[model samples]
Target: DHGSQYVSDVFQDEIAFLGIKSSPSYVREPQGNGIAERFVRTLKENLLWVRHFDTVEELRLALLEFKETYNREWIVGRHGYKTPAQVRKEQTAPVSIAA
Candidate 1:
């Protein structure tokens, strides 16, 4: 779930230390990485292309704001027009089953 940098010893060691299982993307299959691709496209269109950042810190702050807005406001068509925040709420909500 990372770029070519994941092949580095530091990256591999960090993930191993964190006990995170790495699932490498499929070779020659762009569709397998569609979600990440779409996110990058969205980020570029919404933040990178529209704004000018004088510093890396400024860009980082803008990205955090953009992430919050996207999760709270953006309607995801694939999720029945639910924002990511809504989907997360539903997923984490307690479920009750009555007999």
Candidate 2:
């Protein structure tokens, strides 16, 4: 999806400040882009917007904790109301087939 945030003047200016050359463009799959945009929104909502970290280390620690909590507890309907950890476990679990 073509989210306004990526192309917003403020966002562009922020990236430019960090020496990043960001360009917004269309992708072949519109649906996939929405996933990325939604993730950015979720990350901002859950972690960035709510917390004020004093240092990069503090931010890193918080992000790690957030990731763990998200994967272990956040239930997604697409995964049949299962947490990401459960889905990953099912995916990687050894498959047994009785002969």
RMSD of each: 4.0, 6.9
Winning candidate number (lDDT): 1
Clash totals in order: 0, 0
The alpha-carbon deviation from the true structure for residue 98 of candidate 1, after best TM-score superposition, in angstroms, is: 1.1
Worst 10 residues of 1 by lDDT: 23-32
Can you give the lDDT of residue 69 in candidate 2? 96
lDDT of 2 by residue, 1-99 (tens): 457888889998999999998755566667666766887898999999999999999999999999999999999887899999999999999999999
TM-score of 1: 0.74
What's the true lDDT of residue 23 in model 1? Answer: 78
Task: Name the weakest run of 10 consecutive residues (lDDT summed) in model 2.
Answer: 23-32
Off by over 4 Å in 2: 1-27
Q: Write the per-residue lDDT of candidate 1 for residues 72-93, one digit (tens) a residue.
A: 9999998799999999999999
Candidate 2's TM-score: 0.68
